[model samples]
Target: MAKIDKSLYSKEEWLVIRNRRRLEKQLKKQKEQISYPVKRKSSKVAFVLGNGVSRAFVEPEVLSKLGVVYGCNALYRTFAPDYLIAVDVKMILEISKSGYQNTNTVWSNHNKAYSNIKNINYFQPSKGWSSGPTALWLAAEHGYDDIYILGFDYKGLDDHSKFNNLYADTKNYKKSNEGATFYGNWLRQTKTVIRDNKKINFTRVIAPDNYQPIELNNFENYNTIHVGDFQKIFDIS
Candidate 1:
């Protein structure tokens, strides 16, 4: 008879304890996020983009008025908006003793290993998704109505960048474990969802580009809230 690797069980138990403490801490702190709930304002959703150049155009003051600004981890470092949603654990933070690969934005909630946001939900990794649009779509599924995508540039080598690529140490990719899309990629997929679900009254706010604005306008019931500039349209007065 072969002996079982009993050592594996101890590591598994440790993971459970670690994950449990993390969840408990999140539940305790993030309850304050009720202030940013979609119900509080109604069917208005702002798809706050991360640190892409397009974000530079958003005019932060304008975005805040519509509702809660759920910016990416970059926002945590700079904007520090009312709500912050970090999708990948590895990207936003790196657990290294030497601090070799650590990039920007370390969570201030350093005491507890799991502390990220208060009341805001941390994205659990979804397997078999290609682009960041998958995450945005998931966000829509979670009930963010009138979705507005601010900065999803996807700008990198060959003008293609993955959500987690910014922090990757090695260039290996497996479809099983990667985060979602941003900018133009996120916008297009969201629009497709709206079109596919013909009967749904989906309001998607996005940047005004040459090709998209015209094509989307032709669609019958799709109410597209194409803004000149989020900063200007919202009138950050």
Candidate 2:
């Protein structure tokens, strides 16, 4: 067995642990505060974004007006949405651990812009195998009325056919993604989640030209939503 790092248990680590415990306590105190019926209903259209969303929709006002669930990268320096939700902490940790300090720097800078934002949420999978899909599925399972995934590209920025092209490294901090194959597992789970849940009114659309054929069929709800259509649907204009 490897020796434990005594330095890891230093003052900074203790302080973070203390804060987390305190936060949990405070949250438990709010159990009563959550008993009230939810006033604000989930939007008819909710958006999920990843890096793929960057260039796809130039005029995304329709999506912008509805609820937006931003990915980790989207939660960056000096840019953010009115509301946001994040998953894929595993990926973030990898990037953060690359000796680049990218995660902390980006979050710190972007948090300033999001200070006035109303709701910021985060969720994780039950386990590693279930992370991304579960996060999206849970959003709809709980109370989100409609979900529109904007930039959840699940591929590299330059790749034409594949999505999430950079997430496959099960090896190192800066490992190859085996070409974003992880998302295939996520998409498969997502399809079943959609099929099993009928009460939920959700539609998922990938960006223009990014749709993978046979795989897209797995999702029964992959309808084409145009820019104008999104505006009319969400009344963003």
TM-score winner: 2
- For candidate 2, the 10 contiguous residues with the lowest summed lDDT are 102-111
With candidate 1 superimposed using the best TM-score fit, by how many Å does residue 62's alpha carbon deviate from the native? 3.2
Q: Per-residue lDDT of 1-237 in model 2, one digit per residue for the tens? A: 234455678888877877877897778776643332222435554555444443354344434545544333433323443333333454344334443332232221123333343332222212233444554554555455566655555554446333342222333223342334446676677676667666655555554545543665555555546445654766654
- Extract clashing residue pairs from model 1: 30-118, 30-119, 131-181, 132-180, 132-181, 133-181, 152-182, 152-183
Deviation in Å, model 2, residue 83 alpha carbon: 6.9
Off by over 4 Å in 1: 1-39, 92-135, 142-145, 155-232
**Model 2 pairs whose backbones collide:** 50-151, 53-151, 154-163, 154-164, 155-163, 155-164, 155-165, 156-165, 168-177
Model 1 lDDT per residue over 1-237, tens place = 234455666988867866877897787665543222342454356454444443455566566667645455434434545444444444334322323214322222222344543332333322223234443444454455455555444433232433333323332222223443444544566567566655444444444541244555556645545455444556743
